[model samples]
Target: MPSKSSARLAALTVAAVCSAASAVALTSPAHADSVRIHDIQGSTRISSYAGQKVTDVAGIVTGVRTYGSSRGFWIQDPNPDDNPATSEGIFVFTSSTPKVAVGDSVTVTGTVSEYVPGGASSGNQSVTEITKPTVTTVSTGNAVPAPTVIDAKSVPARYAPAGDTAASGSINGLTLQPSTYALDYYESLEGMNVQVADARVVTATDPYSELWVTVKAHEHRTPSGGTLYGSYDSQNTGRLQIQSLGATADFPKANVGDMLTGTTAGPLDFNQFGGYTLVANQLGTLKSGGLQRETTKKQSRGELAVATYNVENLDPSDKTFDAHAAAIVNNLQSPDIVSLEEIQDNNGATDDGTVAADVTVNKLIDAIVAAGGPKYDWRSINPVNDQDGGEPGGNIRQVFLFNPERVSFVDRAGGDSTTAVGVTKVHGKAQLTASPGRIDPADDAWKSSRKPLAGEFVFRGRTVFVIANHLNSKGGDQGLTAQYQPPVRSSETQRHAQATLVNAFVKSILDVQKNADVIALGDMNDFEFSDTAKILEGHGELWSAIKSLPKSERYTYDYQGNQQVLDQILISPSIRRSCKFEYDSVHVNSEFNDQISDHDPQVLRFRP
Candidate 1:
């Protein structure tokens, strides 16, 4: 069926920073810089031909997607020819396209390709063509700037660098790399601080911590048919792994493409991935004042604090805890307990040759040490080994984090890995009746499904059972049975099964303890109003963290222009009486320019 929708690859990108525009009113910049052609550096002005396409175009790459659904991407160069930085130039798109990602430099091109915003809709420019295409590397006059120590806040959280964005500082570019390219031009200038000018937002294929950008680099195919190159975007490339804490009182939201002028945490680690890669240390947002966050202060006996954050892709990957250890521990304000999904099996491997040889649970404990929070402790009732279930990184499941002083892990019950609750559990003879916007257990769709995790915890004098859930999603394999309908289906049978598992688990618990304080958190993977959600909350006494707010204010994740409540926190009848929840609207993957995980986190606050 030939759809009528325009099929042009539309890469979402922010505008270049200019004195004239506001944050939301972003416009594409123009590419119009003069090419002072020098013989590799001697400095000689090249003659400007009447219609020569060559120009010194520099800008943050706002968008990067395969051109025409092929294996190439267009680097939106906004600062070509220096014409107020509007959308201009085409840096070429090919299978051999350099590892240049979005949010980095779109420099080193010989000609230009321009997209006229909105041929149909005014102000929305689309790249129509590329006049010339050429590739370059550091060896070919593209001198990467020295590294520097910049705050995470200093870097633009969503905005790209404007042309002429000043360099905050400089570090050792060459010395930053423990190893370099054979040409000696250096791969990732580790331990060095360099400011890339006129940058723009790109995409983050990984989670929140990592970013992908575009820049001029030489790329070639290996004998195995894979292309090799390094990322040039500031967010992903030349990353300031470490930095001094920015204004200990405030942690600002990081902007996209902002130059991370910081030093490497250690020497570069290299393998087939690239010549070598370095980890950042002492990193902070480079912008003036970044996201404001305060450490937890001592509170009285009756004070209760709760929070929610999307700990992106909290897989069993060792890095889940390692990468954002500080954010989880310190920035998290030490919530009484954190409900997390995507906790992978300790012994899992990464597709990109990353991840240490450890399970996510154990590694998270270690990451707490790395992030300066040793007191944060965690556990999971669903004790699936790395290979327990057939997940990519072992059993990438959901678990919980607790402040040992505030909560303790007691035990687990209900469905095991082998005999997970499935469609049969949903049907059975218990209730043959199905209500409107309700899931019928008789549906064959949920015949096989992954059960939810129910972990018991004790806080103060009350017993709290926290169920960390990642319900069946809309996509994935059939045997996985992790399926759900998109956008509109309030009651998906498969999703209903997921809701059923949690319901059954809760029912079994209530049966044991009449007024058990139960808090179900993590990525439900379903919106608050969906049939699955209605079934979960149908019990009149239960409370949803987001239920207090209007529909617009309730969203833990965003997808395809629709904001849905996938990440949620549900409270049982007893807990909802005194403990009100505070759903912190932190940025999840998509809008925050992160691809860490598809779901966000939800926090619960209770007062004695």
Candidate 2:
């Protein structure tokens, strides 16, 4: 039906119709006026009775929305088959009556009348004597489910920081604010996981005051007042609060890199920063995994750092680090920890041209160790054995390289291997094939299972967590667009999964170390603004370090007619100190060697 004001216009239309009919009678019988309505369907029965009045019309209330404070509402049977869903059904001039909510099954009765085609009423053909008006409930409707409280740990591995949930890691600097507030929104959650992502928390004044925390979740009320919840967990949780207990027990004590987990009881209210109003309950402490023990000591005072690169299938025939090892060994651009992607391995055979063929991945490590320039080390390797590459066999590309000189490794694990990490449930293909997951290019089957690799690194002054990833390649035998689009081929789908796993892993890290300095680096296949990059940058917890640099140096990889910044070096805000981070696009790979690998090695230079 038309809105309340629209209904009044309908009345005016009827009056005009009557005037036109009177004029027609005075003129000639052949020139009489008439009203026309499109698709009367259920109202067709009344069309036959030409001038008869329709006191009551009935059908399901498919759509409804209240307008103008609480004046009146527009109700319609969105069903295409039912033609009685006209804009002029029964105009309820509810200037004094209560307003109506959407989805209310109502029976409206009024004096029926037709509107003249153009001279009088234009859209609707009705004038009813609103009687027997009543609204009932929809039948056989699905019940709304209760809101599912999510733990920070429940987020996917790709999103979590390295060693998130580990008991030993710590967050050093924490500054809270007072004049903070929350925002009200339901869709497109991009900055809800961490507090610093949206608003900066100034130093706390009362000392006992709780720091405002936010959560992300979707909330909706059904026709029957039943509430439905969706995964708004991305960036919607508004500002809530948490209190301090003792040394390591206080919430503020949680380092800049510590992850905190909780559920939203309702929308966040800034007034309740340190308390548990919007929060349903506290999950536990957020910690990057325990520190790893260093087998070697620090030789150079160079600032300990981690960097990611897309070596473009570093699987060379010569299979020795000596080819591009100079970039990794040279102190001017060498990184303490390096996260690499597209690293291919031999089929455990001695031929067929593989990078690890002559000198396995282990040999590269030995060479770096033998040279002993700055003295580096490594962590666990998921390797090609861990992937499902189908008939071709799982020649998996991975993330595993570190510096033992400045950092120590206490322990390591992969997949959703620990209680504090991993996904509890994975929606089946049917749930995602045609849904929102489809809009996302990364939503593929095989890729979801491959997962990302994470590790814990300890520096003398600070413990930095590292998350290394090499998401699915944007281009395959198919093309770049297919990397994230659906109807996903196994290969393309796996790459999408790689992107997803990385997103979840980072989210997990934020869960444990809200403000901890985390470094997420690898070959993400796409540009910095692509969906994959947006997922990590959505929450301000991590920023692409290169983005802070000059635009000319922003790019990390190049291709035919296109030069994109595919590889990324992201870091937590707190880590901005102790380092003036920069990426050197050393043309080593593209130099005289006719390309050391497909990708130019990105050199991250960080000086204390």
Candidate 3:
């Protein structure tokens, strides 16, 4: 299981820029020239003067940063250029502490380089930066240029232009169309000071001292006050990541639906995470939104309540144990069965030949019981040490918690990490040969990934098959704001194979008994609208339950402000034919600042 590298590589990158700067040093222009900022940043994504040195690039210091790995100052020309397709400012990358301050007009002589935030391999757009600078202050107390306003009407409705097919759908070769595409408009203002007034918070402030807001107020607003990321086609163009140039301690915390009152002005920067981010020099006041966590009602005696939650690589040593227990007890209403993802090894990430998760599972069960929940029993096979991918040594896997009073686990032993589970017919009923067994564990699809765990359960004398899965994540995929239009999903092929395996397993149970109740649930790690989901539902063997929610309420995970789905609960034909099921993508941790897990829990109440 891999994680998203967007935020991990998001912060203002300096080392890679310095590395790229040296690589292009040998390609200096034959003759040095005095070029305007607009001349340096051409009409395309890549700068026309890249790898060439410029003399006396004149501009006023709009913002300066002496902290962080990227210590530099943003400079903008007071006399603005007429063409909207070219930027009037650029970032002067000073290796150490910068000497310049705001309102100081400086002439810098430096090499114009295109620094791709997460490197070229990440498929991120290159940022035009003036690296290895020699700065000279022309005047003190000079007037900084007025900030450009970015609002609902300013950004284009369209996200980006189609890249040339010859270049493999890369939009870098295309000319900037600021009026027609949002990515082009943002590129036209790179490193220039801009502002958004009274922006609405679409994502809660993260521990990285960053948050996200939407300039387009009413664009795909969800009930929880976050913008919905419905599809790849409709990427909300107005969503911009906000990070302050101020101290991290002084940064304000806000939740979804909160407002940053007044104006937040800053220099537009292209980063690895969310593409165009505003490094705010002057931040706005934060106003509370009074957002609260949701609670689901208890299941009726006839209804079997089931839930899936990713505890975010949880171990016995984590501090969020009580909070997580509360969420399962109070918010989730203590479901009869729950599929818990990311339960780490016995010693957490120590990785000393340990594979058991008894300590990790027992602690959560104890906490649940202490929080007025049931004395739930659990079952799961320990993954082979370091074989499953996750936090290096933190061998995480899915564990099932069931209340013995309500349901009984079928104990047909011989389940292990590498053994594949198969379906057998018993008097016209479907049963697993080995309960709590891994599904197709020997296949390459489970290589360095968590294998789906299948278990047999009997509720009210009726057999049910539950497959808990934490599939391969979207780690190697290109981002939405990548230089290539629609970006590359390199991670999808492995996930597609994984989905096909699980779908075939579900089909096996149905082939024996068509009405077998099969419930596949957990962090699928792919969207409901994605090909992974489609493959998991192969030939109508299964149907994803998340689609039952309205398009606006379909998300269970929020990343860089766009709420989308990465967890799901899908059912077999018997369950779907009943048409008496209720699904809830409960909003708890995703919208709140104090969260135990990054993903929200999902609950399904149905009669089996």
Candidate 4:
């Protein structure tokens, strides 16, 4: 699970895994001892026998992992200690194909060590393992220990415990209380065999043969069957990632709401990326739940439809143009104005000083027309080559596509990637000095991030100002399953500043002309209930349209197993008060296994 390919292992690197394990190379002559697996695991997360040698640690091989960088065998003691604080099972890191089989009774002699994935700077939890293990198989065909069943009754409702402030809020030193906290419950069974019956898939199976399931059914469930991560306190603790010990191609391809029919049992592993996971040797049978992608109703002629979609670094070389065009035309119902994010250069990511995306954008336009949609005119400001933070060479920027038959783009001169758009008064109304301009391009808040693109549009003779944004991502933030309780989100600082800048810009426009029709929307890389969203809606300057929907239906993205809000459409008070507000967080990709993008498009329909 420490590989970088899967989401559950993104935080781990080979350097970190090797360094942590090999740091304590105190190799002494092996001496027979009565030391057990639990003695090495100890009560806390760190091993008490760390930097020491343990010989003749008896256990039965429960699972064998013969591939990947972490190729090893999981040995679980048949006769576990009475205490639930320490794990009975431990991983034998052979560093290659293991000469062991499941049900083999064996004794291992190795150096007890703590391998911290992603390094110590990452604040991730360290897994206790026996590195450089010399194992001797005592017998074969021994019955494995019965798996500890994990269900709604076993896992506690409380997600985590507050760490001691004296230790910088880290829970590493604290004793595990299995009945008090869910994290502790999972940690108590770390590396030991566990099972969940009839587990419902929350996150669709990813491309890397990984999926997520929840042991606690109906815990903050969405209408689409995903567990909701609506607030910080409600982190959906029942969710657990699943990976198999068998062939990767044999893994099930499941979507959200699909069911795992029988018992899904395996070694409960504490991973760096997705927290506690089931490295399943016995996988569950798949059963479809009839989940389908949703399509929004077409906008009436009287009502204006505006949508924001992240095409996920669309380029001329991508084959998803037709699928995206179908999603725009057929699913989004050909919105009058669409703010498309992540539009790359013509040769997308081929950094040859080529910044123009006419081919890329026009090809999509052509696909849209071919899909029986209107011939939409587009406007965008090309960003500096490789300045925006995305794929290294992909100059991803926001582009606006407006149908001339329904709406017209208010194009003015002198707007470029570096030029900041200024709000001014014209005929007792608000107007942009340069249409299709970047908002505060020189500001430090937008450094290494996509700058907000401000564009002007006229619909039914009423001017609407749209600011499309793709702010700084949530990189470098500690995950939910860090060594520290309430993991730190350092990336929120930049996003908060970005939100404040956008809020000020919106206020500036409203200051000149009260009740201006302004809509700020895009992949905010945050939740609607987050502080970033609160800053964007500062002093009621803008209202997040996503909140208009019920809490169960507000998600636009799926991460791990929690359905959350990363894309949003927010409107000024003018549209909120004057127009009949209607918003839909479109569900096309986030809930499907075959996804074109990780984010779902959001559409708002209103009359002005």
Best by lDDT: 3
- Model 4 whole-model lDDT (C-alpha atoms): 0.87
At residue 92, candidate 2 shows an lDDT of 30
TM-score of each: 0.46, 0.41, 0.97, 0.96
Q: Write the per-residue lDDT of candidate 1 for residues 203-292, one digit (tens) a residue.
A: 222221333222221122111111122111211222212111123223223333333333222222111111122222233234321322
| TM-score, structure 4 vs. true | 0.96
- Model 1's TM-score against the true structure: 0.46
Q: Is candidate 2 or candidate 3 better by TM-score?
A: 3
The best-first sequence of candidates by lDDT reads 3, 4, 1, 2
For model 3, residues 1-608, the per-residue Cα lDDT tens digits are: 24433446444445224454333233446446888888888888888788888989999999887776778889998787788999998988887889998999889998888877767688888878888899999899987899999999999999999888998899987999999999999999998999999999999998777899999999999987899988878689989999888898888788999999999998998776778889998899999888989999899998888899999999988998889999999999999899999999988879798889999999999999999999999999998889888887889999999999999999898789888888889898888989999998889998899999899988888888899999998987888889888888998999999999999999999999999999999999888989999999999999999999889999998888899999999999899999989999999998877778889999998899
Highest TM-score, which number?
3
Candidate 4 ranges with C-alpha deviation above 4 Å: 1-17, 21-33
Clashes of 3: 0
- Better by TM-score, candidate 2 or 1: 1
Q: Write the per-residue lDDT of candidate 2 for residues 1-608, one digit (tens) a residue.
A: 00012434344222212223421111212211222221221222122322333333443332221223212222333332322122222223233343343335454443223222222112111222122234334442322212223222222212111111232211001110111211111100100111222221111112232333323221121111111111112212232343321232344322111234322222111110111122112234443222121111223565665666555444434454664455566532456777665555655323343323223455666666666544555543433343423113324355456666666753633233212233222231111111101112223443333234566556765556666665555432221111111112234445554555555555555565554556677665556655556666656666677566554344444321123466677676666554566555443332111344545455454543
lDDT of 3: 0.88
**Shift in Å, residue 149, candidate 4:** 0.4
**Ten contiguous residues minimizing lDDT sum, candidate 1:** 478-487
Residue range 370-409, candidate 4, lDDT tens digits? 9999999999989888788787687899999999999988
